[model samples]
Target: MTRESEALSLRVRRVLHAPRAVVFRALIDPDELARWWGPEGFTIPGVERDLRPGGSFRITMRPPDGEAFHLVGEYRLVEPPERLSYTFRWEEPDPEDRETVVDLALRDLPGVGCELHLEQGSFATPSRLALHEEGWSQSLDKLDRLLTAEGRA
Candidate 1:
């Protein structure tokens, strides 16, 4: 859920059914990210990554019934299993959209799994922030399921 929100920022925190290191790997690894990185009904067909500070990354997301979307980002920081920071922008950005920063943090939770803390934005408006909130909520739900079912796949 969104931890807090202001005119220019959004924060959300979620606990996943995996360890911090495992969740971190899923976020940084292209193959694993492809499994659960978009809104519900959307699938990521490809990802190219250079997971180091200042490195670039690209991912193509295909919705079941819409045109594909391309997202490009540059890593701002890579702190292994604990934190990641990046800049996010769409290749075909909306007229009102601009590059935004996203910071992801993972904290170990002993026997309860791992905590994912996501803080993103400076969205052009509250509506835009709402859109991101919906998207990320669905995507994170997918991530939870993917991690829980990892042993089966």
Candidate 2:
């Protein structure tokens, strides 16, 4: 199914076969994150998340290229089982490498499904936005598979 949300930002829509609360918890819980946080080939080494406004997150990962990268961000908004917004950046101290805002929202559907819609905005340039869009799409595809498996077991 197509998940569409137009809100002046980059968007991604995925229909998950789980309740909104369950899916939202996976987004907020660090333990659940390590299971499926990145793309198919990446692995998370550390995950620290505080799921409230003014709270932050730190995650470290190793790519297939054997290089380690870190994502550190602060939660800007949190509306439980509904919406989450945050500021994202690479772990580097350099200001030029920091990314913009990422917003994740969950909408409960009529039946036993939930639609996850993500918005990534405030990119420094078009090239950066494009790369983020592709990367997030791939990551969410992995997340879809992961959540589906989790729901089964």
TM-scores, one per candidate:
0.93, 0.84
Residue-wise C-alpha lDDT for candidate 2, range 85-125, written one tens digit per residue? 88988876444344678888898886757899987866555
Worst 10 residues of 1 by lDDT: 1-10
- How big is the positional error of residue 114 in model 2, measured in Å on the Cα after superposition? 0.6
Model 1 per-residue lDDT tens digits across residues 89-117: 99999987878899999998888798999
Candidate 1 deviation (Cα RMSD): 3.2
lDDT score of residue 58 within candidate 2: 93
CA lDDT of 26 in candidate 1? 91
Best by TM-score: 1
